[model samples]
Target: MLVVFDLLYREYCRARLAEMQKLLLLAGESAKPSKEGHGAADQSHDEKDSLQQRGWHAAD
Candidate 1:
């Protein structure tokens, strides 16, 4: 039981960390202004990254 909980908790923490990293990356990007309409595209790429990367929680 303890092992199970530990595994689940680890997974949860990894997911949350991945989610936070995605948020930080996106926030870092949005903090910048660009003449090109690439923000959406870049955000989409970040969204897709979580999907492709394991132990990641993708934001809706």
Candidate 2:
């Protein structure tokens, strides 16, 4: 039972990581043109602010 639980947990983690990677890739593609047309620094600042507002932190 313990071994089965471990395997299940690992599979769940792998699926979740894959989903996150896909989302990140999509976001990157969407942001490319905007980043190039605007300024890199401005885009970075906006991303940081948005993340902060959403309660995400580097320390996390």
Candidate 3:
């Protein structure tokens, strides 16, 4: 029973570590500047329009 618990705990830790590493990689990528010069402004504008079409008011 102790051996089984240890194995399960190790597997859980490994999975959590992998998930954390993936998130760190994504965070690192997002921190880099956009190569096209335009950044969040362009993306936000498009998103705002999409939201309006979906009846998502800013005040709401």
Best by TM-score: 3
Per-residue lDDT of model 1, residues 1-60, tens digit only: 999999999999999999999999999999987878777889899788876775444432
Q: Tens digit of lDDT per residue, candidate 2, span 1-60?
A: 999999999999999999999999999998876435578788898899998877865556
**TM-score result, candidate 3:** 0.57
Q: Write the per-residue lDDT of candidate 3 for residues 1-60, one digit (tens) a residue.
A: 999999999999999999999999999999997678577898898798898877855556
| Error of model 2, residue 37, in angstroms | 7.0
Residue-pair clashes per prediction, in order, are 0, 0, 0
| Highest-lDDT candidate | 3
Candidate 1, poorest ten consecutive residues by summed lDDT: 51-60
**Can you give the TM-score per candidate against the true fold?**
0.54, 0.56, 0.57
Instruction: Give the poorly placed runs of model 2, Cα more than 4 Å off.
Output: 34-60
* Cα distance off (Å), candidate 3, residue 20: 0.1
58, model 3: CA deviation in Å?
42
| Root-mean-square deviation per candidate | 13.7, 8.3, 5.2
Prediction 1 TM-score vs. true:
0.54
Residue pair clashes in candidate 2: none
Global lDDT of each candidate: 0.87, 0.88, 0.90
* Candidate 2 accuracy as lDDT: 0.88
Q: Which clashing pairs does model 3 show?
A: none
